[model samples]
Target: MDHTPLRIAIIGGGVSGLSLAYYLQKFGSEAARQIEITLFERKSSLGGNAETVWVDLGNRRLPGKPGTPYRRWADLGVNDVNLATSPHLRTLLAEIGELERLKPLENTASYFSRDGSVALTDDRELFRGASDPSHELSLADGGRLAVLIALLHRSAIDLVESRRITPRYTVDDFFDACAAAPAEMLSAAANALNVDIDWEDPALPERLERLRHTVYYPRISAMYFTDDRGPGGMPLQAPFEYYRLQEGGSPPDRRYFEHGVQHWLEALAAHITGPLKQGPRVEILRGIEVEARLSTQGVTLTERAPGERRWEADLLIMATHAEDALPLLTFGDGLSETQRELQHILGKVRYTRSFGVCHTSATRLPPNPNLWRTRNIEIRGREDTFHPYRIDYVVNRHQNDAETPCYDRAGLPQFFVSLVDDLNRIPRSEMLDRHASPPDAPASLAGAALGAAGYRDRLPAIESALEAKAWTLFKHNVLDAECLEAQAEIERYNQRTARRRYEGHRGVCPLLFAGGWTRGAGLQEQCLKQSAHLVALLLAAPERRLNPLRLAASGGQARQRHSQASGFAPLPASL
Candidate 1:
């Protein structure tokens, strides 16, 4: 047996890249020792979006006793994990030996209208009860809820059957089909889905192609069903029996770490490099950039630093965002026709940007304190379609501030993470010092206001500099879909070329793509699932070794047939 280590180079340290390394080391077994990994991350931090910041409450204590300023951690990006939709992530946590650290977070939410009126509120999660909470709903609100639920179920059912449905149909299209549905209800549901998908032109219904139903159904259905083979599990199979389970209510088991997600990332990296029964197999490099030169034989990775070091690998993993990964690959002469086409398909994937600002601001929430919930949707005005739904997440409440309860305690203000489409909507006082870059920075609304109000004088001695800043802005690469057909094409391309590379096809580079952007939008589960699949493929071919982990093969043939029926032509393999 050939006992040579399969050199693998990873280019991103985010969930996708980090998880891939973990799985390879965990599942590779005896063959694992025969695999060597070198991961490069440009950022000094490892977990890309899973960032946690420790905030000192100094004199601004919430629910705790007033002497010393309470110190607490805040998640600035990718906060909670829903076990129902994050089964893969759950498995990862278990493998890393941190499953016991999981804590439950309340995922309840209330939707508010432009005038601070309650449009809809669901407390199934908060109460943990089976009884419906709609008994007190007015006739009109009750009617709207009924219609919205029916529409979601109908879309899920049609998508599962995949018959008589347009492959390119979008959430907007599905909403428009129900013309009799009230406009206010439709708007409410759209905002509930997340945000105005059409960030550029919210006025145009035609441009609202945020995600195709083919993509959205599986995701939305997963959220509702939470189990295997639910409404969306087997779209082709009859799901009536599974659909009936909706009555039980798929309450999200929002999970988090008492410390932060960063702890998990560190634990995962440590476990991967920990005392392997055989020997050390993973090497992680931080604060470095890597560039790859692809060829039919293998991949050559070069460090983009002063030393100009280089290393050869059996395969290359571009486990970063599509935009960041594109420039890392040297695209000149060593590439094959298929390889170029793969890059083209990747380039077709699109991304949209949004901002998450963490601040101690109650102004972003509704005026009525009684309506404040774990997640509050503040609809400024329905007519203001360009940007709808300013989502203010009660960080303390959602993360269970009972230990440090921030609300109505000592008359102290609560901390919120408001998600906004436009950065300018946020007051300069509430944005992070580093993120207040010019061109995109919001107006200086509080320069004089803070000074006039003596905000600095109120800060504790140890917290003066940072506490003066009310917000820490986290810019997110929000996943938006222009055409998911590109994803289908890429999958087909990979399957068609998988065997060719194994057989030593002259111009094939053993390259695999994994990231939230590659499949749908940026979700933690998506990254884990994609990385797991790649690990399975890597351990199963060429060398013909088996790994303990197995990923269900994506039903590519069926999707291909649907793509053809929908008239999605394969992207030509041309320069």
Candidate 2:
């Protein structure tokens, strides 16, 4: 066989694949001249899950045209873009000259039950205000809660450094410690903190047990924080603090996307597809089936276009979401045993169910507002529909216009509420029966119920309720579920084996594994760091790559310092 330039096919066109393409073009060596790269997308446009759509409001018109309607671009999913998850994304944006576009979302404010109505719950104020006596806490109980907080704070600090915390901690630890403390102190602490812990309630033990088994242990195992308190009421405590300490400060303003993230992504795609002229010249074959085979020559991919033409490539990189790409690969000569095994491991990578309702031409809410929380509503047979958690409205914080909120100015506010149920654990049949089908009609229920009850009624209640002029319901899976430990181990094994398999070909495959699932743990910062690691792997592969830990330990200077510090000096050249 002729030793020719390598042909590379990037299977998914999401951010990961695009990022890889951008860097491969920017950094590949002169030897990379032989590399031919093609990026394939099942969808006509790139961005994959990151796509956004503009909803037109017939009643609302822009200033110049009375009859012309206005539209607001609704980010169908991924409302928050964490700077900490992946520096590669940040670097990619910077290379494209769009890093300035990164922005931060407002600090979250929650609402909880108060006097049979909802009241504001600010985490900062809640922690700060705990010292005040009027808040009420018995000395003993207060001491215990204080001790718990201190331990948690310490644990959080440790997690920041090592990214590993023991999964053995349970709800019993929380309750037992409180129970063992002085009764008066516990009572006072409860009163002072205004925490609603009903010790005498018959369901207390069972609730605590449920929390231990389902929430606390699982979250600890997954290495992500849970709310445990606040409106969403997750089992783990101090979520925002965990992120702040680990990732180092809040992300760029999320609402700063002037034209929307899709705009930036499109701009990025245009630059890569048009100018950089990188590796494996991309031949986009829309509406074609991709087939992968282990040919005698090497791995060959045959793309069959609509009219029955075949296109082949030496190597294929699957960058689409695992769920979507898994099916595509399975259709061909079955995935290698190793790949099939990896898929099974990936199966344990759970996702949370999320439902978004978009309302257009509706009365906008105040900037950085908190929607009210209702009593833990149970969906009969569904354990606790509200059990794991839910989020009200992630309002646009970058909305600067006092009169017109959000950039598009469709005269409506963009609010996203998540249903937050464990997608993996739920039976498929039950999920289909419960949520697969859309409601008979799109009701303005969420906006009306959460808004009016939360006391945003500067306008008449009836008017506020009627403000929801038009709406749409979207159901998708949030990549925020816990991966069981057994599955994580399998993934680790598969990754090692896959890396070894590619090494025999002389050229290491540029295919990289990423996403929330592959991040070891699901913290946003972990995802960001993984992105950096992927970039490093791509840069140093088949030659100078450093071990994962050493790279992480030395930060970006691992290669430079490792050689010098190890005392394995290179011999001088003879004259």
Candidate 3:
């Protein structure tokens, strides 16, 4: 084996690993030279949870002889890619020429409750589309909500008075403020937190008040669907705030390959392993157990892939979720006491499970341009229920043509609904052994009195309901079970414990963990930024022995270009 060339092995070919590979190939000098890179994925395909399915319109022949085939992407996990985390994602999209295919789901409607009521949550719709006078508000409700919002904003401002703002406030404290303050006041506080509120006038207090009323408060409790129980639940604060802040725009001006995200990822993999000379899907070891070790070469990974074969890597870049990574790492393995202590702290990170139901049919819903729905009912033991949180539905507009309103496509409504659930209360053991478990582990009956903080007591019921409903809906449409499971695994990996383990090997390992799980920020943009930062660090490493002449020449050119552009004269040739 050639020791002169650096051998890099990236475990888990998910978004994080793939993005890192992309950046490394584009930026690393020796990436094509001395650097030997190999990406290992347990699954046959890449893209991890970013999987898409194609629904055959021809199969469900409608009134029209042959309908066009359209591809449906399962955002089984992530839907909204926040722009704040990584601007490079936009650049990546542009480079791939698929930026135009990126369409922002219409931000018009949100589910207020499980009963399927729609609310105009978007600012444009709230201001112009509100039909009911009460929903629109008559100066009085707006005024009251406004006054409350102002006070809440003032309190938040006071909390950070003269000090750096930090995410130090507990979720309880934040919810208490919302619950105690007037609806309008809560709205104002929401606006301060980046919730968009549309006001016609720039300065009028009344207009401002109307905007405040539109600020949907976060449900402090857990949320569940009365119609169908599920394995997953979500925090009221995250989804509510997310929906309230979600913005939309026309589709990007690029073309999607039409196959799905998997297709694109396959193309990326080909570019890396084929043209880039990196090994592609070298080997997939399914039930391989991993444990941490240390040697003179630095941190070592003891991996038992499928069979009796055991392998070791000088540096292992784990792109798996935190939960999956947890079983691979141990605190006793050459870890410092401080590292062990930090692991304890990181283990506290938690996760919530969520489910999605995608429906495609020959008929469509009414042509309500701004159709939206938000969760309304607040389930006991689960507080966070309502708009921008828990579950959301999206109706694709591009499928409909000029004569047909987006919602009125041959009377067939194709909608995707997401249902969020809590998993903290439910034990993993119970889930794996639901049949053999005790009576307490069984599903709860409908309308059963679920005591406060009794999520464990209610797990079986929720899980049962989720399975039944999911299967029923999925049977009618195409199902993406593997993608859904991958998404769940990703969520489990985001827990605090997983974070501690990864952070523990921070400086010691050449393998850097950069992903949504590592940072607990699951947005695509964040992943891109982390990838770029990691690539830059790897490229600048002095130990790599990159040519100094190349560096100086590049620097000289940069200076020359800067001087010429700034209209400065060349440096004098003085001795």
Candidate 4:
């Protein structure tokens, strides 16, 4: 007797969706043999943001095959995923036999968010002018740093739990409360950099406006919006977990894959898209634009490609960012309870505009070794209303296989620069150019952009460049106080729907959400946890669905697998 199998539709073929598909095949293959899953991706390939491309060095011929040229591989999106920071991914990588492939990354000890600093008298700040070189950095003692963490963690937990009885809470509210001391410390630091920031504005709004840049800069970098040296988010916050703070300074324990991040993603893809004897028959559709419509019974996905106009699914998972996901849900009515709930939650998110280009030019590579190992060369840009935004290099960020040809071919390190819109404020499409130099830099800065590196004379013209336009950086703004109220409303609605399941209520929205943005921080670490959350929801729902914290608390199957390798977390990266 064959029973009807559950049909699931996944939107966006990035890591989150792919991980979901992998887990479904892993856990559901036995119970739900006939489970059907379909994944749609707008890009020609899977692994959103995890693109592994190669550069051709003037037609370097391959061995035996003279006509064939060698192409050096580079990562466009995520570079590394630490098993310690994200243990869940370690589990997945092990399950798919990608664990041993992880190798420690080079030390990015010295970093340059701004090339040179200005001289300053105060030594208790984060910086002094780059010229001084004497007062580069000063940090609070171990006890004070500990206090900062304790205060931040306690306040956040207290505020979030308050939602059980009170109204709403947003990330913004928490930051507004916690940002004062940190902002003051940063102000002294930035002043040392010779950057003009009005830290002493009289009005509250004006003061906060100036302060937001200093506070959010690290948070944004943590999301991979710009180049970063270490985990750059607050503890127990949305962007990332708050631990790993350093009193003086700490080097990031990074590990790059021999094959690259796509190596992990493709493994998950193979589980679903490949032929497996005891696997769910998951179908992957690429290069398709999707529009999803929600209804009481189920959802309809309108795909634009291969002449497929409409398709139905019992469940829909939107793995896209908030902005891209909004227009797809068109019920045509004014609004339904469920439709409005999804809209309000998703609409609150904001994003910063930025772009990236991979090129063969050495001009963008930093002359500093600290910047060299980090693969980040911070460049100060022409002034704009937006404060603290910067452009930086990201090449060699994921390098582990020291293939000399990649360096010898061009006689320079391969470099990619991630420039924020705050540098010029021009539209990304308009800003892209064939020249390696930025269009908005001043005439004086143009030739000197390399900044005493002396490589300006040696670097080649931007022979070929690939532009990633308006890549989603980080949340432009934190969650607002009103989000708590809205989330509460969603819970109440879902509760009602669940109670009416016997009355054909379709089992409380019947939608599951998973993505880098959905939980933790917007990085590979968070994506792994978010994926596990969805898997837990699918297999062990009602008891605990989409609750990553619960997953973290319950030392279940993942924990068992983890014990076999390392204790508690993966071994600390060999510094």
Candidate RMSDs in order:
12.3, 13.4, 14.5, 11.6
The best candidate in terms of lDDT? 1
Instruction: Estimate, for each residue in 273-369, the C-alpha lDDT of model 4 and write its tens digit.
Output: 7665366778887667788876656778887657867888877777766566767776634336667777777665544443334454444444543
Candidate 3: where is the Cα deviation over 4 Å? 1-3, 30-33, 55-73, 82-86, 114-120, 123-166, 171-264, 276-294, 298-312, 330-342, 359-389, 397-411, 422-511, 541-575
- Judge candidate 4 at residue 237 and give its lDDT: 35
Query: Order the candidates by lDDT, highest first — what do you get?
Result: 1, 4, 2, 3
Whole-model Cα lDDT of every candidate shown, in order: 0.52, 0.39, 0.37, 0.46
Candidate 1's residue-wise lDDT over 1-575, tens digit each? 44677788888887888888877776666443378888887756666655555444445543555664444555655666655445577667876677877887765555555464444444544543232344212122424333334334434443535556443444444545433333432444344343242223323332122111211233333221122222222222122212322111233346767566666776777777666534338888876788988776678888888998888887788887666776888754666575578667777654434445567657777676655667665433323323321467777776665544443254444677665545456665654332211222112211211211101222245244454443333323322233245656756665555566545466665777776666544567667767766776555553334323433223222332332232201110000
Judged by lDDT against the true structure, how good is candidate 2? Answer: 0.39
Candidate 2 ranges beyond 4 A from true positions = 1-3, 30-33, 57-68, 84-86, 113-118, 123-154, 157-247, 250-256, 276-291, 294-297, 300-309, 330-336, 360-389, 394-512, 520-575
Reference-based TM-score, model 2: 0.60
Worst 10 contiguous positions by lDDT, candidate 2? 566-575
Candidate 3's residue-wise lDDT over 196-293, tens digit each? 44333334354333332333232222122111222122222222222111221121111122233444555555555554353322333322345555
- Over 18-99, each residue of candidate 2 has an lDDT whose tens digit, in order, gives 6556545554443323666677665454554443434443456567877644434444334445454334455566777777
Better of 1 and 3 by lDDT: 1
**Which of candidates 1 and 3 reaches a greater TM-score?**
1
Clashes of 2: 26
In order of listing, the candidates' clash counts read 4, 26, 49, 12
What shift in Å separates residue 369 of candidate 4 from its native position after superposition?
6.4
The candidate 3 region of ten consecutive residues with least summed lDDT is 470-479
What is the lDDT, from 0 to 100, of the residue 31 in candidate 1?
Answer: 49
